[model samples]
Target: MSTESVQGGGNDPAIEVTPEAAEEALSLLEGEELDTDEAGLRLFVQQGGCAGLSYGMRFDTEPEPDDLVVEHHGLRVFVDPASRNYIGGSKLDYESGLQAAGFHVENPNVVSECGCGESFRT
Candidate 1:
Protein backbone atom coordinates (compact mmCIF):
# COMPACT_ATOMS: atom_id res chain seq x y z
CA MET A 1 0.00 0.00 0.00
CA SER A 2 1.07 3.60 -0.54
CA THR A 3 1.01 6.35 2.09
CA GLU A 4 0.04 9.97 1.57
CA SER A 5 -0.60 12.91 3.89
CA VAL A 6 -3.71 15.06 3.88
CA GLN A 7 -3.75 18.72 4.80
CA GLY A 8 -6.04 20.84 7.03
CA GLY A 9 -7.17 18.27 9.58
CA GLY A 10 -4.27 17.60 11.93
CA ASN A 11 -0.67 16.50 12.00
CA ASP A 12 -1.48 12.86 11.44
CA PRO A 13 -1.50 11.44 7.92
CA ALA A 14 -4.82 10.29 6.57
CA ILE A 15 -5.50 6.57 6.63
CA GLU A 16 -4.67 4.74 3.42
CA VAL A 17 -7.09 2.57 1.57
CA THR A 18 -5.96 -0.37 -0.50
CA PRO A 19 -7.14 -0.60 -4.10
CA GLU A 20 -9.24 -3.65 -3.30
CA ALA A 21 -10.85 -1.94 -0.37
CA ALA A 22 -11.60 1.13 -2.42
CA GLU A 23 -13.24 -0.95 -5.11
CA GLU A 24 -15.32 -2.83 -2.57
CA ALA A 25 -16.47 0.39 -1.00
CA LEU A 26 -17.46 1.74 -4.37
CA SER A 27 -19.42 -1.38 -5.09
CA LEU A 28 -21.32 -1.05 -1.86
CA LEU A 29 -22.08 2.55 -2.55
CA GLU A 30 -23.31 1.72 -6.01
CA GLY A 31 -25.58 -0.96 -4.61
CA GLU A 32 -27.30 1.67 -2.53
CA GLU A 33 -27.75 3.83 -5.64
CA LEU A 34 -26.25 6.81 -3.93
CA ASP A 35 -24.97 9.65 -6.01
CA THR A 36 -21.24 9.09 -6.17
CA ASP A 37 -20.54 12.78 -6.19
CA GLU A 38 -22.51 13.27 -2.99
CA ALA A 39 -21.71 10.11 -1.10
CA GLY A 40 -18.66 8.83 0.74
CA LEU A 41 -17.53 6.21 3.18
CA ARG A 42 -17.12 7.52 6.71
CA LEU A 43 -14.60 5.92 9.03
CA PHE A 44 -14.63 6.66 12.71
CA VAL A 45 -13.47 5.31 16.06
CA GLN A 46 -15.93 5.03 18.88
CA GLN A 47 -15.71 4.11 22.57
CA GLY A 48 -17.36 1.26 24.49
CA GLY A 49 -15.61 -1.73 23.01
CA CYS A 50 -14.03 -4.23 25.36
CA ALA A 51 -10.62 -2.76 24.60
CA GLY A 52 -12.01 0.79 24.89
CA LEU A 53 -12.03 1.58 21.17
CA SER A 54 -13.91 0.16 18.26
CA TYR A 55 -13.78 1.08 14.61
CA GLY A 56 -16.82 1.95 12.53
CA MET A 57 -17.62 2.49 8.88
CA ARG A 58 -20.72 3.43 6.93
CA PHE A 59 -21.95 5.08 3.76
CA ASP A 60 -22.72 8.71 4.31
CA THR A 61 -24.36 11.26 2.08
CA GLU A 62 -22.66 14.16 3.71
CA PRO A 63 -19.53 14.65 5.76
CA GLU A 64 -19.26 16.62 8.96
CA PRO A 65 -18.10 20.23 8.78
CA ASP A 66 -14.62 19.39 9.99
CA ASP A 67 -14.17 16.04 8.28
CA LEU A 68 -11.01 15.35 6.34
CA VAL A 69 -12.03 14.04 2.95
CA VAL A 70 -9.72 11.98 0.81
CA GLU A 71 -10.44 10.46 -2.54
CA HIS A 72 -8.91 7.08 -3.26
CA HIS A 73 -9.39 5.22 -6.52
CA GLY A 74 -12.40 7.43 -7.28
CA LEU A 75 -14.00 6.70 -3.94
CA ARG A 76 -14.50 9.35 -1.30
CA VAL A 77 -13.48 8.65 2.31
CA PHE A 78 -14.28 10.91 5.20
CA VAL A 79 -12.26 10.69 8.39
CA ASP A 80 -13.21 12.72 11.39
CA PRO A 81 -10.47 14.69 13.11
CA ALA A 82 -10.68 12.84 16.41
CA SER A 83 -10.35 9.40 14.85
CA ARG A 84 -7.46 10.60 12.76
CA ASN A 85 -5.04 10.38 15.67
CA TYR A 86 -5.69 6.72 16.29
CA ILE A 87 -5.94 5.70 12.63
CA GLY A 88 -3.25 7.70 10.98
CA GLY A 89 -0.95 5.69 8.73
CA SER A 90 -3.31 2.76 8.87
CA LYS A 91 -4.30 0.79 5.79
CA LEU A 92 -7.84 -0.29 4.94
CA ASP A 93 -7.93 -3.69 3.29
CA TYR A 94 -10.54 -6.17 2.21
CA GLU A 95 -9.80 -9.83 2.75
CA SER A 96 -11.67 -12.71 1.23
CA GLY A 97 -11.35 -16.30 2.35
CA LEU A 98 -13.30 -19.50 2.43
CA GLN A 99 -14.61 -18.72 5.86
CA ALA A 100 -14.85 -14.96 5.91
CA ALA A 101 -14.85 -11.88 3.77
CA GLY A 102 -14.60 -8.46 5.36
CA PHE A 103 -12.74 -5.23 5.68
CA HIS A 104 -9.71 -5.24 7.97
CA VAL A 105 -7.61 -2.40 9.23
CA GLU A 106 -3.87 -2.57 9.76
CA ASN A 107 -3.38 0.22 12.23
CA PRO A 108 0.10 1.14 13.34
CA ASN A 109 -1.26 2.90 16.40
CA VAL A 110 -2.98 -0.16 17.79
CA VAL A 111 -1.01 -1.39 20.77
CA SER A 112 -3.37 -4.21 21.66
CA GLU A 113 -6.61 -5.90 20.63
CA CYS A 114 -9.15 -8.02 22.40
CA GLY A 115 -9.00 -11.80 22.04
CA CYS A 116 -12.01 -11.82 19.75
CA GLY A 117 -10.38 -9.04 17.71
CA GLU A 118 -13.45 -6.86 17.85
CA SER A 119 -11.90 -4.01 19.83
CA PHE A 120 -8.52 -2.34 20.13
CA ARG A 121 -6.47 -0.15 22.42
CA THR A 122 -3.90 2.28 21.19
Candidate 2:
Protein backbone atom coordinates (compact mmCIF):
# COMPACT_ATOMS: atom_id res chain seq x y z
CA MET A 1 0.00 0.00 0.00
CA SER A 2 1.05 3.55 -0.57
CA THR A 3 2.56 5.48 2.34
CA GLU A 4 -0.32 7.94 2.12
CA SER A 5 -2.80 5.13 2.71
CA VAL A 6 -1.31 4.34 6.11
CA GLN A 7 -2.65 6.22 9.11
CA GLY A 8 0.45 5.85 11.21
CA GLY A 9 0.08 7.29 14.69
CA GLY A 10 3.50 8.87 14.23
CA ASN A 11 6.46 8.76 11.94
CA ASP A 12 8.16 6.35 14.32
CA PRO A 13 6.21 3.12 14.75
CA ALA A 14 6.80 1.14 17.96
CA ILE A 15 6.17 -2.28 16.46
CA GLU A 16 8.81 -4.32 14.68
CA VAL A 17 8.57 -7.55 12.65
CA THR A 18 11.59 -9.82 12.47
CA PRO A 19 12.86 -11.00 9.07
CA GLU A 20 11.76 -14.56 9.71
CA ALA A 21 8.24 -13.41 10.45
CA ALA A 22 8.17 -11.18 7.42
CA GLU A 23 9.28 -13.98 5.15
CA GLU A 24 6.66 -16.32 6.55
CA ALA A 25 3.90 -13.75 6.34
CA LEU A 26 4.82 -12.89 2.79
CA SER A 27 4.73 -16.52 1.84
CA LEU A 28 1.31 -16.94 3.38
CA LEU A 29 -0.05 -13.93 1.56
CA GLU A 30 1.30 -15.22 -1.73
CA GLY A 31 -0.04 -18.69 -1.13
CA GLU A 32 -3.47 -17.23 -0.55
CA GLU A 33 -3.20 -15.16 -3.72
CA LEU A 34 -3.78 -11.99 -1.78
CA ASP A 35 -2.57 -8.69 -3.07
CA THR A 36 0.62 -7.90 -1.24
CA ASP A 37 0.22 -4.17 -1.68
CA GLU A 38 -3.11 -4.12 0.11
CA ALA A 39 -3.38 -7.35 2.06
CA GLY A 40 -1.31 -7.73 5.27
CA LEU A 41 -1.10 -9.14 8.75
CA ARG A 42 -3.27 -7.45 11.33
CA LEU A 43 -1.99 -7.45 14.90
CA PHE A 44 -4.12 -6.54 17.86
CA VAL A 45 -4.60 -7.07 21.58
CA GLN A 46 -7.64 -8.68 23.09
CA GLN A 47 -8.86 -8.66 26.70
CA GLY A 48 -9.73 -12.28 27.37
CA GLY A 49 -6.48 -13.72 28.64
CA CYS A 50 -5.78 -14.71 32.24
CA ALA A 51 -3.64 -11.60 32.64
CA GLY A 52 -6.20 -9.34 30.90
CA LEU A 53 -4.38 -9.04 27.59
CA SER A 54 -3.47 -11.34 24.73
CA TYR A 55 -1.94 -10.98 21.31
CA GLY A 56 -3.94 -11.82 18.19
CA MET A 57 -3.32 -11.72 14.49
CA ARG A 58 -4.85 -12.59 11.15
CA PHE A 59 -4.52 -11.89 7.46
CA ASP A 60 -6.53 -8.91 6.36
CA THR A 61 -7.30 -7.87 2.85
CA GLU A 62 -6.59 -4.28 3.76
CA PRO A 63 -6.05 -2.06 6.73
CA GLU A 64 -8.76 -0.02 8.34
CA PRO A 65 -8.80 3.75 7.85
CA ASP A 66 -7.40 4.41 11.33
CA ASP A 67 -4.99 1.54 11.57
CA LEU A 68 -1.29 2.11 12.02
CA VAL A 69 0.62 0.60 9.15
CA VAL A 70 4.26 -0.41 9.33
CA GLU A 71 6.27 -2.20 6.69
CA HIS A 72 9.44 -4.20 7.19
CA HIS A 73 11.21 -6.56 4.81
CA GLY A 74 8.28 -5.98 2.42
CA LEU A 75 5.74 -7.18 4.97
CA ARG A 76 2.97 -4.82 6.00
CA VAL A 77 1.59 -4.88 9.54
CA PHE A 78 -1.65 -3.24 10.58
CA VAL A 79 -2.40 -2.27 14.17
CA ASP A 80 -5.53 -0.66 15.54
CA PRO A 81 -5.26 2.34 17.83
CA ALA A 82 -6.75 0.64 20.88
CA SER A 83 -4.44 -2.30 20.56
CA ARG A 84 -1.52 0.10 20.19
CA ASN A 85 -1.77 0.99 23.86
CA TYR A 86 -1.28 -2.62 24.92
CA ILE A 87 1.25 -3.82 22.39
CA GLY A 88 3.60 -0.97 21.76
CA GLY A 89 7.28 -1.79 21.37
CA SER A 90 6.50 -5.40 20.58
CA LYS A 91 8.40 -7.68 18.24
CA LEU A 92 6.71 -10.19 15.90
CA ASP A 93 8.72 -13.26 15.20
CA TYR A 94 8.20 -16.65 13.55
CA GLU A 95 9.63 -19.80 15.13
CA SER A 96 9.89 -22.97 13.03
CA GLY A 97 10.75 -25.43 15.77
CA LEU A 98 8.84 -28.68 16.14
CA GLN A 99 7.23 -27.60 19.38
CA ALA A 100 5.29 -24.34 19.80
CA ALA A 101 6.14 -23.40 16.24
CA GLY A 102 4.23 -20.34 15.14
CA PHE A 103 4.07 -16.57 15.41
CA HIS A 104 5.27 -15.22 18.72
CA VAL A 105 5.15 -11.77 20.17
CA GLU A 106 8.04 -10.46 22.23
CA ASN A 107 6.39 -7.65 24.09
CA PRO A 108 8.53 -5.33 26.17
CA ASN A 109 5.50 -3.57 27.62
CA VAL A 110 4.38 -6.65 29.53
CA VAL A 111 4.69 -6.33 33.29
CA SER A 112 3.72 -9.88 34.17
CA GLU A 113 2.11 -12.98 32.75
CA CYS A 114 0.34 -16.12 33.78
CA GLY A 115 2.46 -19.12 34.73
CA CYS A 116 1.02 -21.06 31.80
CA GLY A 117 2.41 -18.35 29.51
CA GLU A 118 -0.81 -18.00 27.56
CA SER A 119 -1.72 -14.58 28.88
CA PHE A 120 0.00 -11.38 30.01
CA ARG A 121 -0.58 -8.18 31.98
CA THR A 122 0.88 -4.74 31.66
Candidate 3:
Protein backbone atom coordinates (compact mmCIF):
# COMPACT_ATOMS: atom_id res chain seq x y z
CA MET A 1 0.00 0.00 0.00
CA SER A 2 1.10 3.64 -0.58
CA THR A 3 0.24 6.97 1.03
CA GLU A 4 0.21 10.47 -0.43
CA SER A 5 -0.34 13.81 1.30
CA VAL A 6 -2.88 16.16 -0.24
CA GLN A 7 -2.37 19.86 -0.68
CA GLY A 8 -5.12 21.99 0.78
CA GLY A 9 -7.14 24.77 -0.83
CA GLY A 10 -10.42 26.59 -0.17
CA ASN A 11 -12.48 24.93 2.52
CA ASP A 12 -11.10 21.52 1.63
CA PRO A 13 -11.26 19.35 4.74
CA ALA A 14 -9.43 16.18 5.67
CA ILE A 15 -10.80 12.80 4.73
CA GLU A 16 -9.60 9.36 5.76
CA VAL A 17 -10.22 5.86 4.49
CA THR A 18 -9.86 2.75 6.59
CA PRO A 19 -7.57 -0.09 5.59
CA GLU A 20 -10.50 -2.42 5.11
CA ALA A 21 -12.31 0.03 2.87
CA ALA A 22 -9.26 0.71 0.77
CA GLU A 23 -8.55 -2.97 0.35
CA GLU A 24 -12.09 -3.64 -0.72
CA ALA A 25 -11.94 -0.88 -3.35
CA LEU A 26 -8.71 -2.20 -4.80
CA SER A 27 -10.02 -5.75 -4.98
CA LEU A 28 -13.02 -4.61 -6.94
CA LEU A 29 -10.86 -2.83 -9.51
CA GLU A 30 -8.79 -5.91 -10.20
CA GLY A 31 -9.46 -7.82 -13.42
CA GLU A 32 -11.09 -4.76 -14.95
CA GLU A 33 -9.48 -2.77 -17.76
CA LEU A 34 -9.41 0.84 -16.62
CA ASP A 35 -9.32 3.63 -19.19
CA THR A 36 -6.58 5.34 -17.23
CA ASP A 37 -3.11 4.13 -16.31
CA GLU A 38 -3.37 5.36 -12.71
CA ALA A 39 -5.59 2.50 -11.56
CA GLY A 40 -7.49 4.21 -8.76
CA LEU A 41 -10.92 5.25 -7.65
CA ARG A 42 -12.25 8.82 -7.48
CA LEU A 43 -15.09 9.60 -5.10
CA PHE A 44 -17.24 12.70 -5.17
CA VAL A 45 -20.49 14.02 -3.79
CA GLN A 46 -22.97 15.97 -5.89
CA GLN A 47 -26.33 17.62 -5.43
CA GLY A 48 -29.77 17.35 -7.10
CA GLY A 49 -30.64 13.79 -6.31
CA CYS A 50 -33.86 12.66 -4.66
CA ALA A 51 -32.20 12.62 -1.27
CA GLY A 52 -30.35 15.94 -1.82
CA LEU A 53 -26.88 14.41 -2.05
CA SER A 54 -25.54 11.89 -4.51
CA TYR A 55 -22.40 9.84 -4.49
CA GLY A 56 -20.18 9.33 -7.47
CA MET A 57 -17.30 6.96 -8.01
CA ARG A 58 -15.04 6.37 -10.96
CA PHE A 59 -11.57 5.28 -11.99
CA ASP A 60 -9.32 8.30 -12.23
CA THR A 61 -5.92 9.18 -13.65
CA GLU A 62 -5.59 12.69 -12.26
CA PRO A 63 -6.50 14.33 -8.96
CA GLU A 64 -7.11 17.96 -8.14
CA PRO A 65 -4.69 19.63 -5.74
CA ASP A 66 -7.37 19.92 -3.07
CA ASP A 67 -8.32 16.28 -3.32
CA LEU A 68 -7.38 13.88 -0.55
CA VAL A 69 -5.58 10.92 -2.02
CA VAL A 70 -5.43 7.62 -0.18
CA GLU A 71 -3.69 4.53 -1.43
CA HIS A 72 -4.25 0.92 -0.42
CA HIS A 73 -3.48 -2.41 -2.04
CA GLY A 74 -1.85 -0.69 -5.03
CA LEU A 75 -4.93 1.45 -5.66
CA ARG A 76 -5.38 5.18 -5.22
CA VAL A 77 -8.65 6.66 -4.03
CA PHE A 78 -9.35 10.38 -4.28
CA VAL A 79 -11.96 12.43 -2.44
CA ASP A 80 -12.54 16.14 -2.14
CA PRO A 81 -12.27 17.45 1.41
CA ALA A 82 -15.63 19.16 1.30
CA SER A 83 -17.30 15.81 0.92
CA ARG A 84 -15.46 14.39 3.91
CA ASN A 85 -17.92 15.45 6.56
CA TYR A 86 -20.65 13.27 5.11
CA ILE A 87 -18.45 10.26 4.50
CA GLY A 88 -15.72 10.55 7.09
CA GLY A 89 -16.27 7.16 8.71
CA SER A 90 -17.85 5.46 5.75
CA LYS A 91 -16.90 1.94 4.77
CA LEU A 92 -16.59 1.19 1.08
CA ASP A 93 -17.36 -2.32 -0.10
CA TYR A 94 -17.98 -4.13 -3.35
CA GLU A 95 -21.23 -5.98 -3.67
CA SER A 96 -22.07 -8.29 -6.53
CA GLY A 97 -25.09 -10.38 -7.34
CA LEU A 98 -27.73 -10.91 -9.99
CA GLN A 99 -29.22 -7.51 -9.31
CA ALA A 100 -26.25 -5.21 -8.94
CA ALA A 101 -22.48 -5.05 -8.73
CA GLY A 102 -20.93 -1.84 -7.49
CA PHE A 103 -19.11 0.02 -4.75
CA HIS A 104 -21.34 0.71 -1.76
CA VAL A 105 -20.62 3.28 0.92
CA GLU A 106 -21.71 2.66 4.47
CA ASN A 107 -21.79 6.33 5.49
CA PRO A 108 -22.65 6.93 9.12
CA ASN A 109 -23.88 10.45 8.42
CA VAL A 110 -26.46 9.25 5.94
CA VAL A 111 -29.86 9.73 7.48
CA SER A 112 -32.02 8.70 4.54
CA GLU A 113 -31.39 7.12 1.16
CA CYS A 114 -33.55 7.04 -1.90
CA GLY A 115 -35.17 3.80 -2.99
CA CYS A 116 -32.87 3.59 -5.99
CA GLY A 117 -29.86 4.04 -3.73
CA GLU A 118 -28.51 6.81 -5.90
CA SER A 119 -28.75 9.52 -3.28
CA PHE A 120 -28.92 10.22 0.46
CA ARG A 121 -29.85 12.89 2.95
CA THR A 122 -28.02 13.74 6.15
Candidate 4:
Protein backbone atom coordinates (compact mmCIF):
# COMPACT_ATOMS: atom_id res chain seq x y z
CA MET A 1 0.00 0.00 0.00
CA SER A 2 1.02 3.59 -0.49
CA THR A 3 2.30 5.57 2.48
CA GLU A 4 -0.22 8.31 1.80
CA SER A 5 -3.33 8.31 4.00
CA VAL A 6 -6.65 7.61 2.32
CA GLN A 7 -9.26 10.35 2.16
CA GLY A 8 -12.74 10.83 0.78
CA GLY A 9 -12.76 13.05 -2.26
CA GLY A 10 -15.95 13.91 -4.06
CA ASN A 11 -14.58 12.58 -7.34
CA ASP A 12 -12.24 9.91 -6.03
CA PRO A 13 -12.87 6.19 -6.29
CA ALA A 14 -15.09 4.88 -3.52
CA ILE A 15 -12.69 2.26 -2.20
CA GLU A 16 -9.02 1.32 -2.28
CA VAL A 17 -7.41 -2.12 -2.27
CA THR A 18 -4.22 -2.74 -0.39
CA PRO A 19 -1.43 -4.45 -2.27
CA GLU A 20 -1.87 -7.54 -0.13
CA ALA A 21 -5.57 -7.74 -0.81
CA ALA A 22 -5.13 -7.21 -4.52
CA GLU A 23 -2.53 -9.92 -4.73
CA GLU A 24 -4.62 -12.33 -2.73
CA ALA A 25 -7.69 -11.55 -4.82
CA LEU A 26 -5.78 -12.17 -7.99
CA SER A 27 -4.62 -15.52 -6.67
CA LEU A 28 -8.16 -16.46 -5.70
CA LEU A 29 -9.40 -15.42 -9.12
CA GLU A 30 -7.05 -17.86 -10.74
CA GLY A 31 -7.75 -20.61 -8.23
CA GLU A 32 -11.46 -20.26 -8.79
CA GLU A 33 -11.02 -20.28 -12.54
CA LEU A 34 -12.47 -16.79 -12.86
CA ASP A 35 -9.37 -15.08 -14.15
CA THR A 36 -10.08 -13.43 -17.46
CA ASP A 37 -9.52 -10.12 -19.18
CA GLU A 38 -13.10 -9.05 -18.52
CA ALA A 39 -13.29 -10.30 -14.95
CA GLY A 40 -12.91 -7.89 -12.05
CA LEU A 41 -13.47 -7.76 -8.33
CA ARG A 42 -16.80 -6.28 -7.37
CA LEU A 43 -17.48 -4.90 -3.92
CA PHE A 44 -20.84 -3.79 -2.68
CA VAL A 45 -22.81 -3.03 0.46
CA GLN A 46 -26.12 -4.60 1.34
CA GLN A 47 -28.69 -4.34 4.08
CA GLY A 48 -29.82 -7.05 6.55
CA GLY A 49 -26.75 -8.19 8.40
CA CYS A 50 -26.52 -8.19 12.21
CA ALA A 51 -25.66 -4.49 12.28
CA GLY A 52 -28.04 -3.60 9.47
CA LEU A 53 -25.43 -3.48 6.73
CA SER A 54 -22.96 -5.95 5.31
CA TYR A 55 -20.34 -6.11 2.61
CA GLY A 56 -20.32 -8.41 -0.39
CA MET A 57 -17.59 -9.33 -2.84
CA ARG A 58 -17.38 -11.45 -5.94
CA PHE A 59 -15.85 -11.78 -9.36
CA ASP A 60 -17.89 -9.98 -11.94
CA THR A 61 -17.45 -10.27 -15.67
CA GLU A 62 -19.52 -7.19 -16.37
CA PRO A 63 -19.89 -3.91 -14.52
CA GLU A 64 -22.68 -1.42 -14.60
CA PRO A 65 -22.14 1.74 -16.58
CA ASP A 66 -22.39 3.97 -13.52
CA ASP A 67 -20.20 1.96 -11.16
CA LEU A 68 -17.12 3.50 -9.64
CA VAL A 69 -14.11 1.69 -11.07
CA VAL A 70 -10.64 1.73 -9.61
CA GLU A 71 -7.48 -0.06 -10.65
CA HIS A 72 -4.80 -0.80 -8.09
CA HIS A 73 -1.95 -3.29 -7.85
CA GLY A 74 -2.97 -4.68 -11.24
CA LEU A 75 -6.51 -5.53 -10.07
CA ARG A 76 -9.68 -3.88 -11.21
CA VAL A 77 -12.16 -3.04 -8.46
CA PHE A 78 -15.76 -2.11 -9.06
CA VAL A 79 -18.02 -0.40 -6.55
CA ASP A 80 -21.66 0.26 -7.28
CA PRO A 81 -22.59 3.93 -7.09
CA ALA A 82 -25.11 3.20 -4.33
CA SER A 83 -22.39 1.62 -2.22
CA ARG A 84 -19.88 4.44 -2.73
CA ASN A 85 -21.10 6.53 0.20
CA TYR A 86 -20.94 3.58 2.53
CA ILE A 87 -17.51 2.32 1.60
CA GLY A 88 -15.69 5.39 0.40
CA GLY A 89 -12.12 5.54 1.61
CA SER A 90 -12.25 2.02 2.99
CA LYS A 91 -9.30 -0.31 2.60
CA LEU A 92 -9.60 -3.95 1.61
CA ASP A 93 -7.25 -6.38 3.29
CA TYR A 94 -6.58 -10.12 3.50
CA GLU A 95 -5.51 -11.90 6.62
CA SER A 96 -4.35 -15.45 7.20
CA GLY A 97 -3.80 -16.68 10.73
CA LEU A 98 -4.58 -19.39 13.22
CA GLN A 99 -7.84 -17.85 14.36
CA ALA A 100 -9.33 -16.30 11.26
CA ALA A 101 -8.45 -15.98 7.61
CA GLY A 102 -10.33 -14.07 4.94
CA PHE A 103 -10.90 -10.72 3.32
CA HIS A 104 -11.66 -7.88 5.69
CA VAL A 105 -12.56 -4.23 5.29
CA GLU A 106 -11.09 -1.36 7.24
CA ASN A 107 -13.77 1.20 6.85
CA PRO A 108 -13.50 4.67 8.32
CA ASN A 109 -17.13 5.37 7.70
CA VAL A 110 -18.38 2.72 10.09
CA VAL A 111 -19.80 4.19 13.26
CA SER A 112 -20.30 0.85 14.94
CA GLU A 113 -19.99 -2.86 14.26
CA CYS A 114 -21.74 -5.93 15.55
CA GLY A 115 -20.07 -8.09 18.15
CA CYS A 116 -19.83 -11.01 15.73
CA GLY A 117 -18.06 -8.67 13.30
CA GLU A 118 -20.19 -9.65 10.37
CA SER A 119 -21.88 -6.30 9.94
CA PHE A 120 -21.62 -2.58 10.64
CA ARG A 121 -23.54 0.66 10.86
CA THR A 122 -22.44 3.85 9.13
Best by TM-score: 1
lDDT of each: 0.84, 0.85, 0.68, 0.80
lDDT of 4 at 84: 91
The residue pairs in collision within model 2 are: none
Better of 2 and 4 by TM-score: 2
Clashing pairs in 4: none
Model 1 residue 40 lDDT score: 87
TM-score of each model, paired residue for residue: 0.90, 0.89, 0.69, 0.86
Q: How many residue pairs clash in each candidate?
A: 0, 0, 0, 0
lDDT of 4 by residue, 31-93 (tens): 878754556788899997889999999999856777777767767777887899899889898
**Given candidate 1, what's the lDDT at residue 17?**
86
Cα lDDT over the full model 2: 0.85
Tens digits of per-residue lDDT, candidate 3, 6-99, equal: 4443344434555665666665566465532365788878886888999888776667777766554455777877777677656566666898
Candidate 2 residue lDDT tens string, 74-116: 8889999899888877889999986767899998888999988
lDDT of 1: 0.84
TM-score, model 3 to reference: 0.69
Whole-model lDDT, candidate 3? 0.68
